[model samples]
Target: MKRTTLALLGLVSLAACAQAPQGAAADAAGSQAATAQAPAPAPKAAPRPDTPEGRALAALRELDPNIEPDRLRAAPIPGFREAIVSGQTLYVSDDGRYVFIPGVNGALFDIRQQKNLSEASLASLRRELLQEIPKSERIVFAPPDPKYTVTVFTDVECGYCRKLHQEIAEYNRQGIAIEYLAFPRMGLGSEDYRKMVAVWCAPDRRRALTDAKNDRPVPVRECKTTVNQQYALGQRVGLTGTPMILAPDGTQLGGYVPPRQLRERLDKLAQGGAGAGAP
Candidate 1:
């Protein structure tokens, strides 16, 4: 699927989620704290139904009745509102007559700031979503006190994914931590997904992942896994291929860049400058 298509699916998924009952309960202590503080201050009033946010939210509900109201907000562009559905960024007209995605017609650039406004929004969304993945759920390779960390959505059967694994030490040496999440290019029920499940379930996940990437046999193992969740996450972040590398702040640094080149790009980002060229 194309990135745009995956992004649309992400929004659809959010609508779907709203119709389903929540699987986890709110923390008791957290709920109590909220309740205790409720009487101290007046609750903010809901937006008027005629307001921009309200109109946008209403229009979104026409698309899917379950879109959470909290996801809608004023957009950077005047006369529009932005909705964060799942991890996708969508812009809705204030009148609620239209919706648009960044990079649909052309790049949405902020000339004064010299930045791609759409990409910036998407990057922030990606970063926030990625940070929510628990450390234990990722297979990581890193140097002590790494200077930077990147999350990579990978398929064990992908050639470039294997190539990147071969140079894992170099990435670590460059003080770049690599966090791996499964994104089996083959669908969920494919052999590739099963192999990834084994890798994640292994006693030594790091080694097992490397072994799978190297085409070595991994003993079939089954346990509760996050492979499916991570794959769905990949789609939400506009992933269209394996080995999609994302910087700490959610900028896509692209696929399988050599360690030195990858480090150079990261260094530029660290120094608050755009990289030499698109990754």
Candidate 2:
């Protein structure tokens, strides 16, 4: 554990040492790792989520309070630790840096209705960050009142995305508020991705996005922002497709959900309530 702690510090120091790369080509590669600065430390013997190392350790400790924290050693992730306790991919803060905000792997479980515990915990936070779908970027179709909300990670080039897009009205009619976050499937270097950036950077982001989805061209321009950060956020939560929908309870819904069926799903979720048999 002592060694792990030291190693985690090393990673953090390295990150501080590494210079940010210049140019659009390099920015995409680094976007996945960009985050807010680590927070202030807690008093001695009291772990807090302000430090990367601290967050990693705290998460591990929370998982197994009885385990010997002394045995953990830092591995690869900066401000995070990888202890060999039982050989799991046990990640935690190297020094209690950042909270190991959990994401759900709901599709992996048998209880389709129930979200994972760790993931459910992160739902409220995710909701706060979810962007409202622009009326222009989307074909406006809203239900009388939305009982369920979802933030969709969308890509213009994806066929499934197009299929989901076609049902925009149907979903809105079901009282499901569908917000969108851009997630270009192709890597940053591809021509498709270049188009996506243009779509995001356009004076009329909504129209440009629509044009891109329709395979029309937009004038190329560059801006340094979180377009890819949004994509990385999706990836961090294991989003693999164009339309990765997140339900209000932090329940993850992948693939397409027609409006009527989606309403039913939301109804079930709302009725069941939070943490109902969550993993």
* Residue-wise C-alpha lDDT for candidate 2, range 1-279, written one tens digit per residue: 332233323332343465556775476656746633546455436445565555656554543354444345566766556554432234544543332322233211112232233455556556555433343443223467866667677888898787777777777766677676778788777887788788777888767777787788888989864677676677665566677778755566546766676666666567764332211
Residue-by-residue lDDT tens digits, candidate 1, 1-279 = 223333344434554455433433445544876777666654446567899888887766665666664457788999899888765677878887666656432334332243445567888999888976799999999999999999999999999999999999999999999999999999898998999999999999999998898889999999999889998999998888888999888988878899999999889878776442233
Which regions of candidate 2 fall more than 4 Å away from where they truly are? 1-145, 273-279
CA lDDT, candidate 1, residue 100: 67
Best by lDDT: 1
For each candidate, the alpha-carbon lDDT, in order, equals: 0.78, 0.58
- Each prediction's RMSD over C-alphas, in Å, is 17.5, 15.5
Query: Candidate 1: misplaced stretches above 4 Å?
Result: 1-106, 276-278
Q: What is the TM-score of each candidate against the true structure?
A: 0.62, 0.50
